[model samples]
Target: MKLMVHYTLKNKGLLFFNFICVFGFIIIELGLPTLLSQMIDVGVVNNDDAYIKKIGLTMLAVVIVGVLMNISLRYFMTRITTNVAASIRQDLFEKIQDYSHNEYEQLGVSSLITRVTNDAYQVMLFMQNFLRTGFMTPMMFIASLVMVLRTSGSLASYVLMVLPFLLIGVVAIAGFSNPLSRKQQGNLDRINNILRENLSGLRVIRAFVNEDFEEERFDKVNKAYEKSSKNLFRLMSSAQPGFFFLFNIVMAYIIWQGSIQIDQGTLEVGNLIAFIEYIFHALFSFMMFSTIFMMYPRAAVSANRIKEAMDTEPIIKSKENGVTQTETSGYLAFDEVTFAYPGHAESPVIRDADFSAKPGQTVAFIGSTGSGKSTLIQLIPRLYDVSEGEILVDGVDVRDYDIDALRAKIGYIPQSAVLFSGTIKENLRYGKDDATDEELEEALDIAQASDFVAELPDGLDTYISEGGANFSGGQKQRLAIARAVVRRPSIYIFDDSFSALDFATDAKVRERINEETTDATVLIVAQRVSTIMDADEIIVLNEGNIVGKGTHEELLETSSVYYDIASSQLTKEELGK
Candidate 1:
């Protein structure tokens, strides 16, 4: 994969040094067997004790050098592999962060997490093994073959006959295992998806009394993953035994032939012993090579997955030389804006929606479910770009502005409040990194969260669990609102943010927000009629089109859709007042 090349090249100098150490180790390994032949033939045949001691000390010195070189090689390999893995992970995370909402939906969060973690680790394992055993195997095999030939040509021929079978078996195993390895990685993704879903939806599963059903669902994927893993390991396991068997048959032939040569006084016992040692070295190297190749298929699959994530180009990207507006007065406008998610171009979720809001004005969108009210407001910040027409903020096209600059001017609170795992102060500080204690208190006061926060042990210092699991739903929503308020942006968006609060707290929070943000544009998407009845202008939508656009009283008098929504939540006397 290209990602592998990109990271491996980062430590090329260290990697080169590591390979040099491998070469040195191979030299020592090949030299030891040759010295053994000399020790037996020249020293023992002539009964020369001095020659034997000299050869023995030389072999010990070579062994010590080889051990030291192996240590250095391992140290460099570990550093290279670990750093490359970290680099790949960082790059993958940055690419994922740049993905637009559409791309996020295309690649699910669970799959991306697995790719960043498990797949990256797989590549690291391959690189480390390749450096340690992979390069040494081929060099050792060639050197051992030459030594065996110098010792006995007949035995070399027997070893040569076994080479073709070993090569063919290795190739066939790799070919058959590659696709299965890919499938195994895919199965792992499925298992992770199920695991994530079950954990996130544990409450819902218990509420619906579907625990047994969820267990059954989990079992199916788990069993499939196990089966795939078992099959892949089985295929890889066969290579080692097959290589050993073929080399063993060649060893039998060598011994039988060497016995006849010795009986005919044509081969010395020392040469025959050395030739057997050389055969074992060659076979061991070939076996190690086979094992390395077995791991390659799985790593290749993982590398491809990592490449896919790194290569995905986000559809929403800033243009080169994108304009940056120096000043924002919170003037947001939608000019005949229409939008559809990536695949449903035939039918827009919001169609030809025209609206405008100025500084200090509160514009509200009131609609039934699936009426595109939330989708319309999201376009102002370019969460998902409009499919047709344009959205302008501060009289400049949103597309023309750098995305970061444009988003800096807006504070968006989604319908579902999400908080990271941190202390309350840390979560609040996410909006404005330099915010002071006074600012936090004021924001909490405006969001009607101050009283509750003061009552908690440690107050703002209290640590929140993941996703704010430690807090109630209403408390989480209040903190979310306070977080946005701390930003003090030009525009404040409350997307049904008050739904979790009671009517009284909702009324007080809205009043406080109005008092504080009188100079900033406020846009709200709410379902309850009471929440938006006081909006300066309310746009009522049905399906994908605007059904009414006017003040609450004007809509009640002129539009039945608005009237029905108001009457459903309030009595006639209340609506009249």
Candidate 2:
């Protein structure tokens, strides 16, 4: 709830005006009844036409003022509520940007999406209702109750008698609805998770022929969500009829007593009319206020979820005034580094790994699956910190350098190529924001993508769909390499980036990279033996341990682990056996 208050208070002036309108609106609503009673009691009864007309005109003016105030209140409330929701979502996104991979895995991705979209929307709806009715209803109820007591203390007793029942009903609804709201939100997250998987992996699901199975899985969750929703609606629906029943009973009793008094000449017809109006306003206001109370439990649940995401402290953050500059660039080393995931520290993934590289040298890592080939390169950019030892870039510890500065020194391409929705030129600019057209073409040439790109109708202006779905796997990978190449960073990390290309194209791309990046450090993680055969050094990993290290020729003779991998991928002639 504090999340709502924080953003809402930013527009204090609008809130003030909203409150003023509500106050004026309430005054007009209560005053109109009083004016009607006067017109009937004095003007009509005494046969004074002018007095009746004057009171009628005053009532008309009051009603007009009420309408204007109502409109202003709604306008201000909408502006404030929309801004608050938007700000919360924007801040949540920026906060997520600062989170490391560990945080991302800790909070499931689909769950985070739900909090950003659905939960924020819940807050928005609650704010709109609260700003409109939350403030106005209580004041109106109290004022109308005062007028009720002044009109006829005897008849007001019936209205007061029904108040306890309504209060208990409101409290009961809030208590029951809260747990249901939480369950509903949790179910929504599951639905989103399944939907994301289905859309992203639609081809795989079809290939596996599991459409029926997937439909059954979706139906099961959907039914559970529907059951919860129906139960919640049932409870709310029943409460409304029960409230009106109590409301009618009170109205009937009040009118019955007022009529008997009027027949006995103890109460005038005008006072009875005024008393009925006051009673209606008072009880109706309480009902409106109760609706706000009912909304509070669900809104509070959403507010807490948003707060949890916003309050998640990113495990990795830049040091205040951390080292940003070094005397050199592209000097990389790992000093006896040992690493494990957050919960699997006892089983280290990369144990006692020590290595170094300088400019003009290419280091390649190859191993069987789950050998931490990709993870090893990720450490250079601090996607996950080293658990035991230090990683140095340009002789400065990675932890000591500002996070952004550390990453700026390296061009990293992950195991998968991900492209956003934009033109070819826009995607390349991600690596170097202000890179020139000539620089882009040069990078495309080096990545072996210039020919395909030139054949396109729009060339650099061709739009790439989300995730580059329109392009082949090989094309996306090459474009990814070009994006990195455009940066011209001091160090380049390619994590299994060439697996999509054929052997011939792979050779050409590597040949181009070798000749071009002579002055920059290059590290490649590959499973293909031919990919790393010409490297300056090759480190082989098995079960997270570096079992062999040497060049291709040297490893074939001395390191049996490297010999076995090379033999499996290369024929007798290629292995020189």
Candidate 3:
């Protein structure tokens, strides 16, 4: 809620002008009733036609001014609310981008998406309604009450008697609905999560013929959302009617008391009529205020969700005076590194891992699944900082280097190839923003993607579907490799990236990369024995520990773990050759 207030204050000038308009509007609205009373008592009762005309014209002018003020208020309110929402959305995105992998895992992707989109929008809607009438309601109520007291304190007392009951009802409804609103928001997150999961896994669902099952799963969440929504609306719906009922009783009482006063010659007919109008305005403003209370619970929940993301501190942070190095020999080293995922510190993922790779060298890591091969390489780029010891690039600790500067020196290709919906050229340009046609084609040629790309009707201009869904598995892998190659970074990491390609294509792509990247360090993580057979150095890992590190031939002779894996994949004669 405080965060929302901060955003509202961003356009103080507009808010100030809007407030002025609201003030003017309240004055005209509340003043008109008093003028009507004067017109009846002084003009109609006294039989002065001139007085009636003069008061009628004055009321018209005030009405015109009130209309203009309302228009001005709406214009400024819309501008402020829309801009504040945009700012909140932008800041939320930037904060998410800064979050480390830990934060991402803690706040799941589905929840983040909901906060950035739906939650931010809820705050915007509240802001729009709040500025439009939330502020003016209280002012109108108070001003109208004062005017009624001036006309007849006895009639105003009836409004005062009913006011506390109305306030108590609003408070009671808000208390009941607040928890329901939070539950509704949670239900919405669940619905979004299931929808995202279903859409992304459509292929797998069809492959397994689980469409009916998924539909059932969706129904479970959807129905929960429906139930939660109905409960919330039921509570919100009760407020308006309950308030109106009480106010109507108060209205009846006012008319009863004012009629007696008129008969006693203490209250004029015109004055009684004016008193009723002021009472309606006061009660109606309270009704509008109840709407604000109803909306507050949901907006408060949304604001808290957004604030949780903003408040999370990223675990990995560089030094304030961190070094920034653009030129390096591409020398990387791991010094007795050990790491465990946060909250599982007792069971370390990688234990006492040590390795190094210099420029012009190829280093390969081979291990069974869950042997921490991918986790080890991720540390080199500081994706997850090492729990113990340090990783260094050239001679500086990775933690001491500016994050962006360190990352820019390496081109990483993950196991899964992901591409946005855009032209092939656009995807390639993601690696090197200003890459030219010649450079793109060269990288494509090196990764062996040029042949298939050129075969397409539009070559580089061909559009890629989301996640490269239009391309074959091997084609996506090759294109992903080409994207990294386009960057020409000092270090290239292929994290099981060759799994999709056939033996021949894999061999050709590796050969071309070796030739092109003679001065850059190459690190490959592969399950295939053939892939790393010719590497300058190979590290064999088992259950988070590296048992052997050497050339392929050296490891075959000295390392039993390496021998068992090599024997499982290659024949004796094939291994010797």
lDDT of each: 0.90, 0.91, 0.92
Model 3 alpha-carbon miss at residue 482, Å: 1.3
Candidate 2: list runs displaced more than 4 Å: none
**Global Cα lDDT for candidate 1:** 0.90
Residue 324 lDDT in candidate 3:
85
Per-candidate TM vs. native? Answer: 0.97, 0.98, 0.97
Which residue pairs show collisions in model 1? none
Give the per-residue lDDT digits (tens) of candidate 3, residues 1-577: 8989999999999999989998999999887988899999999999999999999999999999999999999999999999989999999999998888999999988999999999999999999999988989999988888888898987787788888888888888888888998999899899989999999999999999999999999999999999999999998987888888888898898899899999999999999989999989989998998899879988999999999999998998766878886456689999999999998999999999888889999999999899999999999888899999899898889999888888888999999988889999999999999999999999999999999999999999999988898999899999999999999988999999999999999999999999999999999999999999999999999999999999989998999999889999999798885
Q: How many residue pairs clash in each candidate at the backbone level?
A: 0, 0, 0
* Candidate 3 backbone overlaps, count: 0
lDDT of 1 at 194: 92
Top-down lDDT ranking: 3, 2, 1
Worst 10 residues of 3 by lDDT: 318-327
Query: Which runs in model 1 stand beyond 4 Å of their true positions?
Result: none
Candidate 2, residue 286: how far the Cα is off, in Å: 1.1
What candidate 3 gets wrong by more than 4 Å, as runs, is none
